[model samples]
Target chain A: MKLTILGCHSATPRINTHPTSQVLEIRNHIFLIDCGEGTQVQLRKNKVKFNRIKHIFISHLHGDHCFGLVGLISTFRLLTREADLHIYAPKGLKEVITMQMKLSDSWTNYKLIFHELTSRESELIFEDDKVEVYTIPLDHRIYTNGFLFKEKENERKLLLGNAEEAKINKAYFRKLKQGFDVINEEGELIKNDTVTKAGSAPKSYAFCSDTAYNESIVPIISNVDVLYHESTFLEKLSHLADKTKHATAKQAATIAKKANVKKLVLGHFSTRYDNITEFINEASEVFENVEVAEAGKTFEF
Target chain B: MKLTILGCHSATPRINTHPTSQVLEIRNHIFLIDCGEGTQVQLRKNKVKFNRIKHIFISHLHGDHCFGLVGLISTFRLLTREADLHIYAPKGLKEVITMQMKLSDSWTNYKLIFHELTSRESELIFEDDKVEVYTIPLDHRIYTNGFLFKEKENERKLLLGNAEEAKINKAYFRKLKQGFDVINEEGELIKNDTVTKAGSAPKSYAFCSDTAYNESIVPIISNVDVLYHESTFLEKLSHLADKTKHATAKQAATIAKKANVKKLVLGHFSTRYDNITEFINEASEVFENVEVAEAGKTFEF
Candidate 1:
């Protein structure tokens, strides 16, 4: 899995810095997260294929988080897209989007699907053979949900030399991969351990942003391979963190350390500070494996 | 009066070209017209005093025309603006804007007033001491209206020597500036024209964009000093213009000539075209005082 940072700044878009937006690629699926203004241009700069973005997820309705959505949809319509597009966002997104289209009399040729979200509890929002995604309830000023993508368990591989000589038939192979004992045509028991080996362990990624230092999320997203949490401030401004409902670098590191995530990625920095070294320095005090999330940077797991 | 083109391209924004937005300063009042994506950055690059913009007029709710509004508003809020903002747009815009603020849980500290348009007839919408703005109905695929800003008649200046010889009283000076017959303190009737000369001729500007080549706007915006019109295509693609409810460069110039406008400016060219010379060449065929609207370029009337 590869994740690309399209934009990570807080507040508003600038000539050099953009607001919150990113792209997560797992297996064959490309998911758009929190599209901000100038996102399409950022996507072009990052070399992301416009047609391949099938699903878009918005964390909240902040102008910085989802303002780019309507423009991107309009561009897709202008490009004559025919594929169905799915948007998973908080409730009221449909009304905001439809109003613009209504006044402009511009309709999309493609199927525009909106999956309005209102749940305050964790639930599966999307699932396929390769990955399963669930919403991570967040504590914020508004209704917000973070998404966690967990790779599903893979099928066991048959030990070719051992299985062929062990008289493992095609019918029994299915049971062997599932670690089940199968009786052959001769009515003899066949042990699964001798014919198949276990598959690779599934890896998961958790995305948390625009939230304060909340430890309640640790249980839901524990043991994630990679955790991307917002660090809008450093330890110096820890007092301001609570008032704004945002986390500092130290707080994010504490969450990553408590959740036992393998790697901690920090982003969504406030544009007040000119340098980013302070964030990594502060996060490294609690979490050993911490990295800064820079624009156009990619992380692989 | 000075008109500045913030952006002039159509469709998606590019690294070199912006989508659509402009700024017009009439007698020190700054007006933002059609805020497309990346407008704030454009404003910053052009060194525009964005805080001076007290009013914004949107033609329709097309994403390219209004996507930047929310972000700009948010930026103003972040900057702690305390002035009230006035927006004139079509109906449904209030819902769209308010929903974003509601979802984000962030509203402007200043008063946000909206004038929602739901009619097909032309009407006066804005007025101040020096200028008055009215809507000019246009034909389009959507409910679009062009704006006409006419400089109001100014107070006549007194000819000092003539006023003294006419025995005009200081109390009647105000009435004399209004072109009224003034009675002096000595009970002598003084013709206003004898003491005061006529003020400067009022200048006018008309903005027509994202519309078909409609002639109905001529009567509403008749005899404007300068007209800025959208020319999405050249004369070669006149058929495509008809199909898309847009005008070619020559067609825009034709409207300017028919309306007896003194000058014409063409913009909103499609990104598919490599050069903008075709629009100028086509528009210059009919209108002698024609200028191509380029980004960061300003025109004075």
Candidate 2:
């Protein structure tokens, strides 16, 4: 799995800083998250294929989180895209985008599917043979939700030499890979563990932003391989973070420690702080494994 | 009058190319025209003071022409702006903007006034003591209008030396600047022309963009000191220009030549051509005094 940070700055887009937007690539799916203003250009700067973004997940209705949706949809029309695009966002976002398109008289030629989310409980949103996605309800100034992406458990790997030594027929290889014991040509049952080995462990990721410090989400994202949490403020401004429904670096680190995530990624930084390294310094005081998200940076796991 | 081209490209915003947006500084006002996506960052890159822009003029509802407006307004709210912002755009734009702001629950502290336009004929949309802005109707795929910014006839210059020689009293100096024959202290009538000449000829500028080769606007923008016209295609792609309702360089120059504009500035370039100088070459074939608009380039007229 690879994750690219198109923009990590919060509040507003500045000359060198952009608002929140990221691209997560997992199991042949490229999911766009929180398309702030200037996201299209950020995607271009990051060399992300525009057509590859089939699904977009927005956290909330705040301008900083989802202002770029209309522009991206318009661009898709201009490019003559024919594939159906799916958007998973808060309930009100569909009206906002539809109004703009109606005003411009620019109805898209391709199908635009909107999955308006209104559930306040953690529930499964998408699932396929290889992956599953669930919503992590977050506490924010507005109705918001973070997404959890989890890879499905893989099938067991066949031990070819061991299977042959056991005199297992070639037709039984499929059952062996499925972790099942089968009768061989001599009508002798072989143990599944003797012919197959365990597969690699699956990976999971959770993204949470624009939310206050809430322990309720810790259980939903517990023990994920990677957790990206918003740290919009520093420890010194803990009061402001609480007042604004945002999390400070120390608070994010505390949540990471509570969830026992393998790695914690910090992002959605406020532009007031010039030194981003201070976030790492503060987060590391509680969580040993921490990383800061920067624009155009990529992390592979 | 100083005009800064924040972005001059057509279609989508790219890495190095931006969509249509510019700042026109005339007299004491800074007017934003056609705010495409990424315009707020472009304004920051151009060092334009956010507080000075009290008015924005949108040519049409096309995404490339006015998509950045909602984000800019949201940023203004974040900056705690208290000044009133006036927007002059097509009739449907107000609904589009209002819906987005409502969805985000971000009503600005400042007043947002919209002057929705549905006029098919040229009309005066804005005016003050120093400047008057009129709409120049154009032909495009949608309802679009160009803007004509005219510095109102300036107060006649006071020829101090000539006024003193004419024995005009200090109290009569104000009258002399208003182009009136004033009676001096010595009971002599001083001719206005003897003391003052025309004041800088009242510089005028017209911005015409996202329109086809329409001669209807020629009369409205005729004899303007500087004319910024859209040249979205070169001579080779004139057919496409007609189909898209955009103007080619040669076609734009034809309108400029017929209108008798002092200088013709070509902008809104199509990204297909690597060489923008070809626009100048094609336009120069029809008009002599032609300039090409480049992003971040400023023109003082």
Candidate 3:
């Protein structure tokens, strides 16, 4: 799996920086998370195929997070896209989007679907054969959610020489890969453990932003391979962080350390600081594996 | 008056091209017309100061035209701007913007006034000492409006050497500039033409986009200094233009010639045709002084 950060700033998109938006690639499918304004331009710059984005997950109705959504939908129509698009966002998204389309009198030629999230509790929002996405109900001033993308465990790898010697049938190959013993045509019991080795470990990525430093998320994203948390402020302005319901670099690092995440990627920085290396140094004090998120940077895991 | 083409391409923002957005400077106040999705970036690339944008007029709620508005407003707040920004847009804009702010809880520190347009008829939206902005109802799929930015009648210039020789009092300076001969302490009649020359000739600019070839706007912007109307298609694809409620190069030239505009600027070209010199060449068949709107190019009148 690979993660690409289209924009990582908070509050707004600026001349040099962008708002909250990211792309997660897993199982040969690209999923867009939190499309901020100017995302289409960023997508073009990053060389991400526009037509491949099939699913979009918006954390909330925040302008910085979902403002690019309506434009992207309308652009799809102008591009004459015919693929069905599915959106998973908060409850009011349908009303906001449909109203703009109604006012513009331009409807999409493609099939558009909206899956609204009304539950305050954590729920599974998206799932497929190789990945699953669950909402992490976050504590914020408004209704919000954080998405957690986790890769499903792969089937065990078959040992080539042992499977061939055991005369394993192609139909029973699936059972062997699932770590189950199978009887061969010679009436011999083929031990699954002898014929197959365990597959590589799966990875998980969690995205959290525009939320207070709530410890509740630690349990939800426990042991994730990579954790991208919002660090909107520094320790010097921790007071402003609380007032705005945002997290500082130190708070984000503490959560990453406590959650036992393998690596921590920090973003959604406020436009105050001229240099962002301070955030990296400060977060490194708490969590050793801390990196600052930059626009147009792609992180592969 | 000066008109700058920030972006003029239709649909999405392209590499060298942009969506629909323009800057018309009238009476020294920069007015941004129809902000597309990448307007903030385009504005930065063009080196236009964000603070110089006093008013923004959105023609419709189409994603390509007005999607970048919210981001620009949010960026102004992030810059800690104290200026009062005004927006003239469709009726549902307030609801869409306010709801996004409510959801993110990121309120603007500066004053934001939205003058929503609900009427189908023409209305004067903004007026200052030297300029007036009026809406021109257009034929589009949506409830859209075309804007006419006209320079108001300027005050007469105070002829420098002549005024000094005429012994004009400082208190009567205002009256003298208004082309009224002031009565001196000893009653003396002075010819107004001798003391004052003509001020700068008033120049007007009209912006029409995403509209069909309708002659209704001819009366509103008759004899305009410059008319930048969307010519989405050439005469070869005029049928497609009619189907999409867009105009062709020939149609725009016909409007310009009939309205007696000094110079006609054709823009918002469809992405299909790469060579756009044909648009200008074709429009020049019916009207002289026809130019194609190129990005980052400025025209001073």
Q: lDDT by residue for model 1 over A1-301, one digit each (tens)?
A: 8999999988888878888889999979999999999898899899998899999988888788888999999999998999999999999998888877886778899999999999999889999889988999888788888899999987787887877777667777777777787776666787877778898788899999879999999998899999999999998898888888899999999999999999999998999978998999999989999998888999998
User: Candidate 2's residue-wise lDDT over A1-301, tens digit each?
Assistant: 8999999999899988889999999999999989999999999899899899999999998988998889999999999999999999989888878878887888999999999999999988888888889999999988999999999987899999999999999999988878899998889999999889998888899999989999999999999999999999998999999898999999999999999999999999999999999999999999999999999999888
lDDT of 3 by residue, A1-301 (tens): 8899999988766678888999999878899999998888888889999899999999888778988899889888888999999999998888878877887778999999999998988899888898899998887778889999988888999988889888978789989888899998788998899889999898899999878899999999999999999999999999999987899999999999999999999999998777999999999999999999998888888
Candidate 2 lDDT at B301 equals 85
Alpha carbon deviation, residue B39, candidate 2 (Å): 0.4
Lowest lDDT block of 10, candidate 3 chain B: B97-106
Model 2: which residue pairs collide?
none
lDDT of 1 by residue, B117-178 (tens): 87799899999888999998877777888899988998898888888877777877888888
CAPRI band for model 2: high
With candidate 3 superimposed using the best TM-score fit, by how many Å does residue B138's alpha carbon deviate from the native? 1.9
State the displacement of the C-alpha of residue B23, model 3, in Å, after optimal TM-score superposition.
2.1
Chain B alone, candidate 2, TM-score of 0.97
Give the better candidate number (2 or 3) by TM-score. 2
Pairs in steric clash, model 3: none
DockQ for each numbered candidate: 0.62, 0.83, 0.63
- The 10-residue segment of model 1 chain A with minimum total lDDT is A181-190
Model 2 spans > 4 angstroms off: A167-174, A185-187
Q: Please, what are the lDDT tens digits per residue for candidate 3 over residues B54-125?
A: 799999887778878887887787788889999999888888878767655668898999999978777899
Per-residue lDDT over B1-301 for candidate 2, one digit per residue giving the tens place of the 0 to 100 score = 8999999998888989999999999999999999999999999999999999999999999899998999999999999999999999999889888888887778899999999999998999999999999998888888999999999888999989998988888998788777899988799887899999878789999999989999888898899999999999998989999999999999999999999999999999988888999999999999999999999999998
- Chain B TM-score for the candidates in order: 0.96, 0.97, 0.96
Worst 10 residues of 2 chain A by lDDT: A96-105
